[model samples]
Target: MPERVVPGRPDGLITLGAADALWVDLTAGSAVPTAFGAFTRSPARARAGYVLLGGRAVTTVRASGGRWSVSVGEVRRAAAELNAVGTDPQDLVRIGPFHGAPWQEADEETVLCWRRRIAGGLWEPGRPQRAARRDLDRPYHLAGIDWRQMLVERTRDGTQRTWWLPRAVVRLLDAAEHAEAQWLQASQTHQAGAAVTGPPSHPRRAARDAGGRQATDPEGPAASLRPYNGELKGQLYSVLSRKPGTSRGVAGWACAVCRTAPAAVLDHCHEHGYVRAPVCQSCNTLERPDHLYSNDIRVANRYTRLFHTDTDDWLRHWHRCPGCRARTTLPLPHLAAWTAHTACRSLRPTHRAPRGRTPCGVLRVSWTGSQNTPRSCLLTVTVDCCPSGEHRLLAQVPYREAVERFRVWLAETAPAVAAAAGPDRLDGLPTEPRPVVADTSGEGLALF
Candidate 1:
């Protein structure tokens, strides 16, 4: 047997920025699956939200069967309105399911449905069957000639059904329908543009930037023009045109890396060669070609490119935190301050160590790198003895490697140092969870 392919799951109400909806059989007093086509579409999942029905807010309830539930009495009056309608023989352009007798003398209670358009016109009704009163009272799912505007029920028994929506029900759901229509239209337009332009190009750097040359200086002004490279030009145009918060070509947006700086340049990951986000000139230079840096941006194992306009607010408000390893905390306001604070913390003995050990001979720890520099090319750890004031040079390594070396030294060598320092000194390493602020400016406090 051949494997069956399922269509991708549809976007939810949250992604669409609209109120969630659920299908309900008002007469039966229960909810039904909102989407059909178990074979054509992915498995359905229950969503939570309220919908306006019969002039009342009907809260959505997830049932044990992975469906929704509702009260019959709450929608009984509206059910009558939907059920009372019957087949109108006088109407020339009939579409969707209809109830009542197709001709005089036929049982009025029988259910009759018109087949979809065939040979440019709707076909005659199929064999009339005596339907349960509850089936007749089920509300019509709203639909459009060109776009699917309402719920479509596809049964596993190889049957499809949709009904005609009354004017009152349509009026109640006007906002949701309009929003869905706009989303569909935009998606179609995007697909058409992709067809014309060919597949989008992946992010790559200029030959000079990729060949081990240092990035442009941080103080220099960011490049305002779109990327000149042919491969990047098409993708840049598409991203700028679709990215939200960007109006008049990047004027309305701020850089994602540095919240305070204007978004003057597009930043892409050096390792993966894909656009990450818009960033300021300084941040762009700070990102290394191999992603080796002591900054917060390097913490994420993977970075996401903003593709949806609706996700602009989320990107602006959330960021990955290097201190706590939390991916959604607010960004550190001062990168330099956070780096210095983290370096100091790495030198201290962790609280996991046993208490009552003698103080370590290592009194003061200092590094050689300047705080203002974007990259710490090398880190030099030196310790100064207290009374003798003798300075001793220790290991020198890359900044990130130095941090780990300090952790290992403190764990293994610090206890031996306490014995060498003799019993005269009583000061012990501080083990409190409270972080020492790097400066008086009160920056980088969110890490704690």
Candidate 2:
């Protein structure tokens, strides 16, 4: 038996014309396996996100006892619609799981959907039934049609969905050539010269930047006119709080490494490549080393190049891992980041982070990496001299971290440092959550 390989789809949506949509029914069934008794809820687990547009929908079909049955009138009508619908980048046509509902009734329900044509591809909701040659559940394509719009309307309002085909009046997809009537409208209106919607307005660059390198655009597709960092950094880039302040005037934590007031650096271990608490500048750079540098433009570039592609051919061409022959299931941005910078997050440095030099407390952050390896970074700290002592950590410049986890860690540990620091003039510090022994071992930490 030949080994079957499932490819990840990256873009586009498939829709059927309401008036004629039998062929669409057959095509839709090939993608949806559960109708054939093969069930799937989330495509993300079995397939790649790149296979489906973030906001697009595809038809689903099912089979029973090794065969699918549909009305001859329905098939003829769908075949006519598949050929007649007019398509364009701006205007799209959709046809469906007959009427959009997935339930197997004596009569079947189908959904036809459409979306923007930023990407192209074919996708299926299920798998082929056994080795049967005439299996109607096998996947096919909407050759010669670049569908653009798909809407979902329930039949008489039920949990089950039925599809409505738009643009059923004309033929859009022909033998092997795509004819997008709506897109032609857009071309006519916008001309060959125009900026894609949104910021970073500039003419598209076909290749690398001035120094012969990849250019990054933080905003999106059309936002690459100016210089932008792909590697995230700085205040705007930071997800972790980088400083300490007494908001309501009560302190609970002692700097884990410094043994002084205000445990602002929550779980300040460099092994994890981030700071949980608000960090003092010196401690963050020299004492603790848990920051990542990123430029959104780079991420955006990768996303545009490889995510949500709709065509199988495109998937095969672009999603291969340069690292090895292994087919990649990760998004293009993630793959690019990994390829470009080893894409390691929550990393530890070769140099040791200072534990604490003076009367101080200590905190550790532990988390897993993509490889599932336990990562441990360090942050050495020093304390401020005075009755209201302050312990601080430092490390090299630049920081990067996950936002939510860092926030929770800080909320948990900041109080300890605040109580240790004692009373101060800074306002709005919390007076609650009495100080308790700080847990040096990080908890509730995982790589998302």
Candidate 3:
């Protein structure tokens, strides 16, 4: 006896008698086994047989006898192994107790009936068949499997039947079905010349049809020129061909006020619509129409008076008249008298007047620097005195030179005023005439 290896079960081997068995390697398509040679040569009695190796039916042959009949126990063992390896059930041959009948000889109806009976585990040799629901009799429910798209087909002889899908195989059948239906619908619509609802197929053509030209006109004085006719198109082309600076450039190349940032926009007076000059974006924003009435700008003007004219500058420096509260510009000599009057009026009535004379005049000297440039200063002198008038003087100079000139003026003026008033009149003054120098700490008017 010789042993042959089973196809699926590595531990199982089949024993064959020398005369009854012949080696037939199915994968290589060898000739019919010697055991089935007689049947293959004679067509009249030839019946299709199957060889089960390791429980999986591997090939068909023409043969007869107990030599090919696999026992129930062997069949069960083979099935268990096949199941463990996930073999397809269609690959298996029918298990039978019939006396050496070939599976190919069975009629279609009889084979189908047997298959139905065996598929539901209703057939067990020598054991009573149990009454159980057949697959057709009960609703088919397979875990993770959808049956709606399953397909079935039969072979040419009709003895063997197979399905396109396995019972346990799962797939996204619904999504595939929907996509197929959508494709069919789209094809039908296209054939019928109906418009499809989706993104445009030719975006450039669609944009042209939807008036894209009007939205993309280049901003310029001649931007209004449109190609309504050939003549207009020619004119527009000529205008566009000119050099860049010919029409768009401004005469002045820097902001009028700051004079730092490049002049990039043509600013115009909002009220009159007259071109002011080329100015940077920041300077133009400050002069917007809304800022004319803004309280913040008003407050800012109260301090610097830059928004208004030079007359506001004069009034701010004078501090107004004490008796009439009128805004006036006076010479530097009249400032002492104006200050004295204002200070005398401001004194509280409840407090007794100074026992001796008190000086009521005040003089202030300050300087402003140009924020855009270093070492630049605008020096201003303001004097406030009683019963005469107020005066202010302004000069532009270098920062360090301004400070030096102010220090020199303070040293000279303080003694001259005191000497002119004399010791007798000093008692009527608030204090001896003293010049005050404005300090950088922003504490206004400190007397020196």
- Give per-model TM-scores: 0.18, 0.15, 0.15
lDDT string for model 3 (65-149, tens) is 4232222233333334333433232322212222332222212211122223233333334543222234433322211111222
Clashes per candidate (backbone, < 3 Å): 0, 142, 20
Model 3 segments beyond 4 Å from truth? 1-252, 288-448
Full-model lDDT for every candidate: 0.29, 0.23, 0.27
Better of 1 and 3 by TM-score: 1
Give the root-mean-square deviation of each candidate in angstroms. Answer: 27.9, 24.7, 43.2
The top-ranked prediction according to TM-score is 1
**lDDT winner:** 1
TM-score of model 2 vs. true structure: 0.15
lDDT of 2 by residue, 1-448 (tens): 2111123311111112221132333344221111211112212111110111111111221112322122233234334434443333222222223322212211111111221111112222353111112423343222212222232233322332323223221122111111121222223444444445433312221114433222221121112112212111111202343333331111123222223222222332221232233321112222211111221112222222222231222232222211111212222222323222222222322222376333223212222222212132111212223223343322211112322232233234343322222223213322331222222221111110
- Give the lowest summed-lDDT range of ten residues in model 1: 11-20
The best-first sequence of candidates by lDDT reads 1, 3, 2
Query: Candidate 1: where is the Cα deviation over 4 Å?
Result: 1-252, 258-260, 282-448
